[model samples]
Target chain A: EPEVTQTPSHQVTQMGQEVILRCVPISNHLYFYWYRQILGQKVEFLVSFYNNEISEKSEIFDDQFSVERPDGSNFTLKIRSTKLEDSAMYFCASGTTNTGELFFGEGSRLTVL
Target chain B: TQLLEQSPQFLSIQEGENLTVYCNSSSVFSSLQWYRQEPGEGPVLLVTVVTGGEVKKLKRLTFQFGDARKDSSLHITAAQPGDTGLYLCAGAGTNFGNEKLTFGTGTRLTIIP
Candidate 1:
């Protein structure tokens, strides 16, 4: 089965640095989303994208966070300034319409030192 | 906050034992999905229950949606070591709201051979 794929399975960056996490959603899926999980915490919604624009975002998604679909198939999340609290597992997901069943990528672990 | 409260945060069971995990919410959802995640990976969808009181079976695993569509449960029968993982539940609404998912804290299962 086709699955979402993410690059840089693990990332380590200095605080205040810029970092970008990349994802290739399942081919032919329309909606994309980004979620984060702090160690020992529940997964939190970051943002969701459709039609190359952000459709919805949570409070955690602030000025430091941005998402783009620069290409037809790839969705990317960029953090302009990384914070220690930004260290977490970032998961990318895609889904078709209707019930919107999501398929998530293996996740990109981000560690802001 | 739209919280998904999951019961039994951790479980250690012998192989061939049965287990059930619960995900409850006060906010009604358009659909509830169950996912199993191994450490260091994103969650993988196992089943989705959209309608109230719906039940779906995937081999030895059974999923049920609550009568109010506000809760769901995952039951595993005769679980094996391979079934040991972090089980998560997510909720989606029908509001054209980016189709983002609100996830549970997850239940960690350890099956001993």
Candidate 2:
């Protein structure tokens, strides 16, 4: 079965440095999303994208966070400046439609020093 | 914001035992989905329940959505060591244009041999 794929499985960056997490969603999927989980916390929604635009975002997705579909297959999340609290497992997910079942990537573990 | 509360944050049971994990919320949802995540991996979708009081079975695992659409349960029968993982439940609302999922805190199950 086709699945979502993410790059840089693990990343270590200095605080205040820029970080970009990349994802290639299922080819036919139309809706894409980003979510994060702190070491021992629940998965939290960050943002959703469709038609190459952000549909919704949570408070955690502040000015420092941005998402882009620079190409047909790549969806990237960039943190302009990393903070200690930004360390977490970031997941990329996609669905055929707004209400369809979501498929997730393995996730990128971000560690900010 | 809608919140999903999962019961019994951690469960350890012997092989061949049965267990049930629950997801509850005050807000009603249009659909509920169950996912399983192993260590170092992203969540994999197990099942999706759309209608109230719907029941779906996947081999030894069974999922049920409450009649009010505000709760759901996952029951595993004759669970084996392979069944051990983190189980998360997520809800999606019909009115949300982006259809973002609200995930529960998750239940960590350990099936001991």
**Index of the highest-lDDT prediction:** 2
Give Cα distance to truth, residue A65, candidate 2, Å. 0.5
Best by DockQ: 1
TM-score of 2: 0.97
Q: Write the per-residue lDDT of candidate 1 for residues B70-92, one digit (tens) a residue.
A: 99999999999999899999998
Cα deviation of A86, candidate 1, in Å: 0.8
lDDT (0 to 1) per candidate: 0.91, 0.94
Q: What does the TM-score come to for chain B in model 2?
A: 0.96
True contacts kept of 2: 0.58
List the TM values for chain B, per candidate: 0.95, 0.96
Q: Judge candidate 1 at residue A107 and give its lDDT.
A: 93
What DockQ do the predictions score, one after another?
0.70, 0.64
State residue A71's C-alpha deviation in candidate 2, in Å. 1.2
Can you tell me which runs of candidate 1 are displaced by over 4 Å?
A: none
